[model samples]
Target: MLTSAIWLPATLAAGLFQAARTAIQQRLRATLSVNGAGLVRYLYGLPVALALWFGYAAATSAHLPPLSPTFFGFALLGGLLQIGGTNLLIMAFGERSFVVGTAYAKTEAVQGAVFALWLLGEVLTPLVWLGIAISVVGVMTLSLGGKGLKLRDVFGALWQPAARYGLGAGLLFALTSIAVKRATQTLGDGDVVLRALTSLVAVVTLQLVMQGSYVILRERGQWRAVLGSWRTSMWVGLLAAAGSAFWFTAFASAPVALVRTVGQVEVIFTLLLGHFYLREPLKRAEALGLALVVIGVIASVVGSG
Candidate 1:
């Protein structure tokens, strides 16, 4: 029988890989447009995703899982939302510092809990809910930064570009998480790895087709930019594919809410990456917020475990 224990490690790996992918994609913004950078993820990752699916199938001697209408519907919706969510995140990078923008996006855990409970019927324990609350407070603290804890500044911060884009991105990401979980469920009983790879291949292919068409029609000039940056784009593709594989596998193994809440470790990873690599300084409030996030993550894991 599959155990939720599998999701803990899978989600942690996904968080680390995703943090690296976001950092690389942020750098790509220098040479490529938002759409261009986003395109590189799906366009380049398609082949890698296909290879992963085939490699798993061949190694296990597993045949292709039969696809159902429910799977296609959920996968397509999830793919589209994921593309939108990614672009929104890229836009947030332009509006705020890398770590701060990512902090705003991390609000997905709170929103994801609501969506998962409502749409996926995955209920959370009281302890898990407390962990989610603690993590969300930490995220808000990060958004506030070193500003005075005044009501006006707090309210005004939400209207800022970073908050706007990041919250929107979080919402789309939450929806995508629900849809992807639903898609995996539709595959019925199977090897969890094969089910995840199959869903990843289908979702990535749909993203490429949809996003590629848009890039071709409206942003034709960006094609040269995307290809020109193949050196860096390739890294983005590799990390994104690796991260997504783990994410899908986690979804198959555990509740979406639990997976996402634990995935909050991405915020901590982003903080270190921004400080050491990008030379972004950490402030007092931000440090406190990071501490809370860490504590919350530990609580969440224990609660779920």
Candidate 2:
């Protein structure tokens, strides 16, 4: 994967699938407890993750790298961080309006750049950094939901609880991305797809153990509720697993920060699906924000190559 440009499409597909996964998760939420719904993301995903790994290996006759302690160290750290980041995001959404909290969480790209630079020495070109900035601005603009709030007003609200949770989530997620990249790289240069699949399986399995156990112990009742909603829950897991597979592939091949910068297009996907698909009028601010996000994604892609 590193020898080619598959990372770009992989990242884009990751975003698209993530949007779809979130949609399914939302439907799951109607009948399941928050924990139950969240559990479905990893619980059902484990099977899919396992299937993808075995399927890829079988088809490609891929060589499995020796699993080192270092790989497990990074993968475990990434799994835990991802779990924390997700909970923080839910808190952020609860603390403020969904749009506002989501905008703040969308700062992951910028935060990812910082963490990747600090942890992995992944220095980005200036133009790529600029592109990340523009994409973030667009995300914030769309978060306004055409409420006519000034952009500065968002900054003014940073002292609130929502900002803390949002920023914290972004920070953790950035670190998660860094850890994932490091985990994949620990295998050295080899089959990119195989390496990515291996890491994905490791991370998802860790998630299943940690998060699944929690749900079983603390919210045993949620298991029945989730099972009752299996029709929707399984789709959520499938989408999440697919999204994660693409993300792992991208991270295994490219700079984590650049991949994340491109993944910011997920917000654009949400906008298109939520509004245009529903026949809602696109607000002027949202339109401008869309334009900025498009330009930013382009700049990041071009600057990286």
TM-score for all predictions?
Answer: 0.96, 0.92
> Which digits, one per residue and each the tens of the lDDT, describe model 2 over residues 230-257?
8888888899889999999999888888
Q: In model 1, what are the clashing residue pairs, if there are any?
A: none
What lDDT does model 2 reach?
0.82
Whole-model lDDT values for every prediction? 0.87, 0.82
The digit string of per-residue lDDT tens for model 1 on 1-305 reads 23556788999999999999999899988888889999999978888898899999999999878899999999999999999999999999999888878878888999999988887777777888888888877777777775735788878989999899999999999889888888988998888888998999999999999988999999999999998889889889989998999999998998777788889889889888988878888887777787788788878777775
Best by TM-score: 1
Best by lDDT: 1
Q: What's model 2's lDDT at 68?
A: 97
| Stretches of candidate 1 exceeding 4 Å from the true structure | 1-3, 148-150
Q: In angstroms, how far off is 212's CA in candidate 1?
A: 0.4
